[model samples]
Target: MDSETTIREPRAADGGLDLSPVSRGRTPLLLRFTLFAIFFFPATMVIEPLGASGTVPTLLCLVLLLAWLASWLWGLHDPIPVRHPGRLAISLLLLASIASYAALYAGWTGGSTEMTRASADRWLLLLAASAALVLVTAEVIRTMADALQLVRALLAGAFFCCLVGVAQFVFRVNPMEWIQAAMPGFTYNGGDTPFQIRGSLMRVAGSTFHSIELGVVAAMLIPLSIWRSLTDPRGRRWFHWAQTALLVFAVTTTVSRSGILGLVVALLVFVPFLPRLVRRGLLLSAPFVVAGVFLIVPGFVGTIASALGADTSDPSIATRVNNYPRVVQLLDSHPILGSGPGNYTPPDALRILDNQYLGSLVTLGIVGLLATLAYFLLPGIAGVLAARAAVHPALRGLAGAVAAGALVAAVCSMTFDSLSFPVFALLYPALVGLAGGVWRMVRREADLRDDENAATARGAMMARAPAPTAKEVG
Candidate 1:
């Protein structure tokens, strides 16, 4: 295949990054796999094989990692990545986990002695694989058009998840049970409780392990759906808008505070970046949308409201508060690089902590906690700043949505041990990876514009130069 084949040709200033071998119309084979992986990973998150913690998506992640490695070595696409904003941050996170594990084995930590090397090793491999996903994704996205396509793919994936959740809500059936038939060894991956209730309403889990996980994932995708709707053609806008509505409805069904936190954070990050009229339209419609959902699911809004209003009386709230004393003791034993990440095993080991930050402090220690914050926050802040400077409407909207999604992950961390869940864990890192890739493309364009200006200035100088004298020939 000729490398010179251009599909949708990019403008000299802002389409293809120099390192990206992907042309505008062409989806590189790796990226094709990436998109497919994104689509099905959400749906596969519910099944654990052989009564152990595993999913098809987990195997897919390993496949993605190998594909990226093959691409890097075979030079079928970009021989090297031009930028690595996501990789740097993700690598820091992985390094922190390694340090915590090393500390545990060296007897420098206070975690359980019964903790096996295999568990810690699994955690490390997952982190490394997630980082590779970020690296390869950032390497492939070449233009605003590519970004928009990626957004559509992501929205479609979200739709699949939301649809499953909707089925549970409206039809009282779960299609995930069918997967169990194909893979006889597979079992439900969520908690002992398969479902939950709020008032008279049944909480929906979608393709995720728990209702809260589905809600948080829905919250993260809503901004991207809205951004896609705004940027799509007028005829196609309604389709995307309907997706946005579905995502919102899905989140409302969960009645999970974590999901609510993520949705609010997504909107807060997204709305300010929107054009004035668009922003105003969303703000004015907010109450009506709430009213509409409340009308559709009669007791849901009241259920969520009372859940939010719960003080010390809430068992969930009380559990989180009571865990602090134990966390403090663990932190005191190993102040810098606490016990160990993924070391929390029940019965003999520590139980799950509700807050990711507090959990990180107890498990990963101070350095690890900082790495967690940096991984979740830095790329998002950078994306928002990049969006402000972006000239293309497509690029601007994509950047803003990326920022909003990342912020949702960060904010939702305070509400749950988010990293413990597979889909959210994988999706959040993938968002960071996409941000890095987009950042590299944007930087490439800026550098090209600079070069063009420099060349133009040199040409002008040559054209303006005085005629050479005959004396120079002597």
Candidate 2:
């Protein structure tokens, strides 16, 4: 059978792929669970027993990983794409973590290992959980239809987050606090309240713990949302575009310069892949979106302008500058594996290095840092390859969008301590995993098509050839 035929897919009234679960197969429970973990059990809510690393989303990810493990072990599904570069990179990253931890104990870090021991272990566990999330996502959702399902779920979660952010920034009402109040046992991790005001504008974090974090999350989602909107059937595109606009507007609510930068980066990565008409339409809409924001939020345009124009006097800028020397000095001491993860406590290390590359250099060190770079970048590179090779439009769109998200996540790290906030961390790997998976599917499609073509050629050659003569046969 041709690879384009999906047993579960059904056409929708809009003349596009129906996004309902029925169209994505009956047994994509892990995808559903992953979405549920994103929407209902946010990354902020931690159960007491599991400690700080035991946020509902994190634990749920760990659960999903275990479920995938059992299936793999029991031979319930196809074998994992073990040879994929992203998977290999993540494995290398984890191994690097183990090496770094051992190096710490070997007194290579030249510190009292006891002080950083437990913290380092916790970081290792978190890294493991992060790997689990990325791997399971890449393994489980293997088809275009299921990939669309994942996209829709992520869009919904991002949409919901944007709505909450809008309400917080504009309406002065926060529904997340209500959920927090009702769930007595669950406390928010990262004890930072994301409510701040800048020149009469409310800076809100939405489901994320910090406003800057929300900025990158919005930046990451905008591309995916745009891909969905543009690919959806004619009538439904507006709704998705509206969702994209909400994401854009939500970032403005944060009043963050990095948020603006993320938006710019996402657009730059995503826009080039669009068709001419779509690209023109997208470009033309920007002014209207800006006008809409200005009309709705009054000073939003000025607020965003002010944020973008912020100078070195801004504390975020000043602190980032100060970290350069500190990070360089630390790198001199333990350049290979540095100190183990979580050993860079704020007080002991002087201050947090918000840069992901720098912190990874200090904590995970050079070898682990290279592994970390591979883990973040390789999947997106694969997606770019897949997009170029893709025969199907859906696969092309998914690959492009996911690639944009991964690239955005990687660059966004330059601005802040990105993965420390589970929201960004969660979505980044999901994007990475989804990219890797989409690439595999595209490759499989190519392989299947080649086989079909080869068989057709053989049949045609046989048909064209004359039958053997009786004398010749004798």
Candidate 3:
């Protein structure tokens, strides 16, 4: 039958493809919940006090974990079939994290109370949840269209945060405080504050608990927005451009040097993947646009200079430099399985390590550090490889966007404890999962096409073959 005839064929009475309104275009309920959780991660902090001591993000993660497990156990009718990747690397990573947590718990000689240890255990749980997120997202996103939809959801969340951040920056107001006031026991501290001021400008945090968190989210969104703007049809391009503009403004208003650097790295990673003409246009216009920005916002230019350590007197840079040696010393003390997760920095120090690599080393030790690196790096590499393999332009573009987002996470990790922050922890792995899913979908389509082409070629050969001669038949 022709393709159109096959598609329109009615379902068999034995319960085949159902074209009814209830089934048509309907997303799985579990998948819907997972996407909602991912998009609203920032609001998790508001529900921190609702569930017995653990933060709301963790609780939500637990809910996701349960949902994923239940779906697996009950075989709840999934529309997209899941393809599992080789699990050796992921298994080893999880094993290392668990081993390190056990060692740390057993060798607890520090003055921290039982409550502290309990809280530290949650970090281990978060690690497991992150792994589960990768698996779940990989299964849910089954096509290039699905991947783009996921990106749009992420961008929408970031756009909302940007709007709130801009308002906070301009009006010197924080909506979180009002939410806290109206809702008893909802204590969230991430907002605009005097300490977030850089030079003469105040930084805005939006719904996240810190300006840096908002900055990181905006940085990650910038490249994705750019990719959408470049790849989308002319009719829809304006929406992506608007998202890109908002994300850029949000990043600048946060005054995060790391965020700015991360954006630069992301753009660098993304530009090569663009169509040649688009790439050339972007490269040509970038310098003029940058100059215009510097002229319009001199303060932002100064902040960038300071972030690059151009100002010898910038205390933040000096502070980070000074902390490196201290972090190294801590790592040396617990080199194998460092002091334990969340125990590297003492209350006396009055600051957590700003560097994620060092923080992992000091807390989880060498084994944990390696595992953490593998967890972050493997999926990112897979995404880039997938981008190279994709035959469809839309699939290739989505894969490139995923890789760019991963690059943002990588660059930002050097300057912040990215894994510890829910915004990065959740979004990064989810994007990686989405990339893997898209890759699988593309491969499946290619395989099916190849099969069809081979079948057609064989049929053509048979038709073109000469009939047996009468003598041969006799």
Q: Write the per-residue lDDT of candidate 2 for residues 1-474, one digit (tens) a residue.
A: 443344554432223333332343332666656664664455657786666677777777778778778887899876544446567767888888899899888887877366588777767767776777677667766655567667777888888888888878867787777776766788766554559887768889887777888888888888888887866432366788889888988877888777888788777876776667888998998898878877877777777776667777877667888998989898898899988876787773337788888888888889878987887788777777777787666667677778778777788788888867777777777777777677777767677667768978999999999999999899
Q: lDDT tens digits, residues 1-474, model 1?
A: 453344454555544343322334343555544544544544344444222235565566667778777876887766354665677788788889989999888877645475455567667766866876687667656655466556666677778778878888999887656654566545544452226887778998876768888899999988888877876542356778888999999899898898888888898888877888888999899999988998999888678889999997787888778778878887887879877877655452134587888878877889999999988888888888877876565566777888899889988888888887766877887788779866776676677777778989999999999978899756
- Residues 64-94, candidate 3, lDDT per residue (tens digit)? 7787788777877462455534133355567
Poorly placed runs, candidate 3 (over 4 Å): 1-53, 77-92, 108-113, 182-185, 189-195, 230-236, 295-298, 311-313, 348-351, 449-453, 456-467
Candidate with top lDDT is 2
Ranking of all candidate structures by their lDDT, best first = 2, 1, 3
| Model 2 CA RMSD to the hidden true structure, in angstroms | 4.5
Evaluated against the true structure, the overall lDDT of model 1 is 0.74
Best by TM-score: 2
Candidate 1 versus the native: TM-score? Answer: 0.86
lDDT: the better of candidates 1 and 2? 2
Better of 2 and 3 by lDDT: 2
- Deviation in Å, model 1, residue 169 alpha carbon: 1.0
Which regions in candidate 2 have their CA more than 4 angstroms from the true location? Answer: 1-22, 78-82, 112-115, 188-190, 232-238, 348-350, 459-474
Q: What is the lDDT of candidate 2?
A: 0.74
